[model samples]
Target chain A: MATELPSNIKSSDVLTDQTSSKWLPPGLALQKVDERIMTLNVGPQHPGSGHMRLIVQIDGDYIVACDPDPGYVHRGEEKMAEYRNYITNIPHLERPVIHDSCNVLYPYVLGVEELLGIEVPERAKYVRVIASELNRCIYIMYWLAIYGIFLGHSTMFMWPAGDRELLIDLMEKMTGARVTHAHFVPGGVRNDLPPNFEEVCLRQVAYFEKRIKEYAAVFYDNPILIARTQDTGVLSRQDAIRLGTTGSVLRASGVDYDLRQKEPYDVYEELDIHSNVMKEGDSYARSKIPWLDMMESCNIIRQALQKMPKSGSVRVKLKPNPKGKGLNTVYKRVESGRGSLGCYIVSDGKPEPYRVKLSVPSFRNLIALPYLLKGEKLGNMPSVYWSLNYWPVEADR
Target chain B: MIGTATGIIRALNSGIKHLAIKRFTLRYPEEKLKFVGDGYQFDPSTGVGIAGLKGRHLLFHDHCTGCQLCSIACEGVAEAIAMVKVPEEHKQNKKAIMPQIDYGKCVFCGLCVDACPFYALYMTNDYELSSFSKEGLIYTPAQLQVKPYVAQDSEIIITSRGATHG
Candidate 1:
């Protein structure tokens, strides 16, 4: 929703004559006013909208009508899938949600493997679950990190990224690359752990638990953050679904539709998911969901570590004729850090995929912004939007 | 009912508190932060990629086994990485593996790494590959080979520990 609309929009609450009610476009139920006001266009470049620009017609600071403009960074990602081979897309797709690379690419690999009928090994499943949960922690860490600034809890923002680096180091040890870990493949993973991975992982998990409390001390305890986020931008369960909000936002709204619970991918089914259901769908609840989710992510990682087989092939043996038996195509949708990352892959009896289309999560969630921001003050915009953690690249991709 | 003075005071108090507390900013050039282990690899002049560092294309020399299989398996997108075999001297028994990287046209995909049986080449994180002249990007065998691998003093540990250093 990164539309850079012009500031030429008439701001006044679209004041109508005393006699009749004419057509006023879909923003607010046109506010009853007398004089016309100047409409201010906030972002494609503005701070509040992140990467999105809203055509916000405002009277003073209160918004009259808001329209979100999108497709600024659309690099034809789905179209690129048609051109790229099956495995090559792991890197291409990973770039969008760079923080949550494993989660984004998990379903893509799952979808492709399901199509090729290549059963990914058990050790690989454990690896995938661990990697995905670690990615979630990193992503949520950034979410709280930046949102901390919006709420004026500066340390919360910095602390999470610094701590998240520990997990990033762990990922680096597992897969050679840090952010873009090309660990997930059609059959299984690229390689196995480089020894002492289990010990290092447990230590980082405990360290994260210690660091997450500092988040409470800095941000949660601070009254400014509490005031700004607690009840601001509230969405009831019905409103949230109608707005198509998912992930922490939906969890905040108390809908509790975590894909980890619903369509349990990898080792998620075996591990008990901790759903942080906040009755209040406010920014505070939304912000808190990820912190709690971070703990759950650690728990899942621990469960995965315990559940992992003693010694087996991390990567399934690469068959000479990979596209053997049949070339059945299937689409698999799994929840990523952003939201639902679904891959629709088609195979046509060749080594290369006939077509691949990725239904990214951020793009879906970006549409929910204008609905939430109807009557809210301009000041609370950064806090609300920051909590959303809209990866513009992921949305535009 | 929020006053302008109150807002300003709150903001000022917060800013002062942040400064009073441990300043999170790294003072990047002056007081550098310690890089945990290995930072993303790179060189100044030539942007040659190392292992798994998704560069535009890979270039292999006399070490390449004459299996043009890499180019053959390159699907959908035209084979950006080509294994052109030019047999110079068979004295050492390995064929002259002359690899050309057309940076003008390459996706920087490490497919060749996955494809190569010999594990002859890989990608590094040197992605500052901008050039005024187009000719600089068209990498030759000697250009790509790890002979005089532009050895750098990254000032990593030194820069971070410099203030404390004697």
Candidate 2:
């Protein structure tokens, strides 16, 4: 919200009051400021804002009020899903968060499979687990890269960007696409893993784990970064749950609830997953949790590879234009890059869905932005805001 | 002050170490990463299509029966494939129609290839399909028939020091 200035003013008065007043339209006159609070529009075009605006009012470098403005990149993905068939919606549904396509499509596939009443093969479950883990790391690395850039750490940005390619390369061999792999479909995945995939996957993922460990020395353990973000924008454990925060943000606040661990999906129950939690409830804790999760994902991938069936079908054959049995609604959720991503589909016994609703984690985590941003310093904005792992595109979708 | 200095030095040291490491970037146009298979193919016996990068479409004029399954599949996702009247007539294609794909609108999802049961359509690793004009992007049936020649030999080589694309 913009403040209204006076309607009329003299040129001499305007020059005298120029220090306190901002430039207005030619016809509008300057108004006398009652309080010294200045409003700053961190617009959508800014790199740090990520297609969302933050209306912040500052009083001497301290943020007095912060209002997050999302929905700049909304494409109405839910409405579009109603027109498309179950099989065709994969490519478009994964577009909101392309790097984490597997996780985004995970819930949709699960819901569709339930509606169809078909069981996924044992091999398919392990393959799905591997893909989901790889996608999780890919999404985290991209988020970390952006977080690094926002904090003015250029080396942090480059390292994650470079290291992300290893996972991306692995994903490409499995799913055919680099980022937007519409591999996960109803009943099962699109195809089986490529020949000689296990060796390549194991080797690359091992190297990637070693590469990620190098980041702690230069980034997470860096004293300057620690001092800047350690105690700033502290979110208490109760506040996090009351505000309905999920994923890393919630974990940082000492809640050890991971969807993969709590409500195990696919082959996640078979594999051992350690939930990383921190009690600090600060930006540093939020930033560190994802790295720990990435390490856990690496272990899960190795375990899945070992337990996966050597020779079996990865997909269950479904009839062309598959439809639900009855007029019913099904809701399925999976742990995505940001947090819990839920997909609710209302089927009316037709090829097309009657209604589709996506409960995205980005939008859910955005509730904590204004709460955390208020009374914080201006310089801490980027570190605190990005540490929440808010992807505006996913939120807006 | 000492802690800050050590942090800065560690960051600088990490950066300098990476400078000695080989670049992971693949110099495009001159080098391309080689794919595993020829293209993404579907078998009628099997429900799933083989895994490969969904790049450019390869159409077989003989096997295509002008059934319009690929066009139907692309309708909801990306309406990039449209059936057009071809000059050459085939016995299988009685309508003398073939699918012409608009690369500009195509998401390269490979659903179209899976929709074709006759093994008439597949995707090749010809991702370098940049065009200057809109008209140039719409590949005709005849154009789609021509197999692209790609010289890709690069692969990721990981050593004790670091990984490099070579």
DockQ of each: 0.14, 0.70
Regions of model 1 farther than 4 Å from truth: A1-37, A46-50, A319-327, B1-63, B71-97, B101-109, B122-139, B147-166
Q: In candidate 2, what are the lDDT values of residues B6-47, reduced to their tens digit?
A: 888997787778777876888977888978787677775788
Model 1 lDDT, full chain set = 0.65
Please report the TM-score between candidate 1 and the true structure. Answer: 0.77
Q: RMSD per prediction, one decimal?
A: 8.0, 5.1
Expressed as tens digits, the lDDT of each residue in A81-165 for candidate 2 is 9889998998999988988899999998999899889899999999999999999999999989988998898888888999999
Interface RMSD for each of the candidates: 8.6, 1.2
Candidate 2 stretches with Cα past 4 Å from truth are A1-34, A46-50
lDDT of 1 by residue, A1-397 (tens): 1222235546454454544344334553444443665566666773522366667666677665667776666776677766666766666777667778888888888887777667777887888888888888888887777777666766665667666667776776666566777667788776666566797688767666765764564566556667777777777889888878778778888887888889988777888777778888888887787888888888888888888997776665555335623556788888777667788878887766777777776666666777767778877777767666577777777
Q: Chain B in candidate 1 has what TM-score?
A: 0.53
Tell me the lDDT of model 2 at B8.
Answer: 80
Error of 1 at A243 (Å): 3.1
| DockQ top scorer | 2
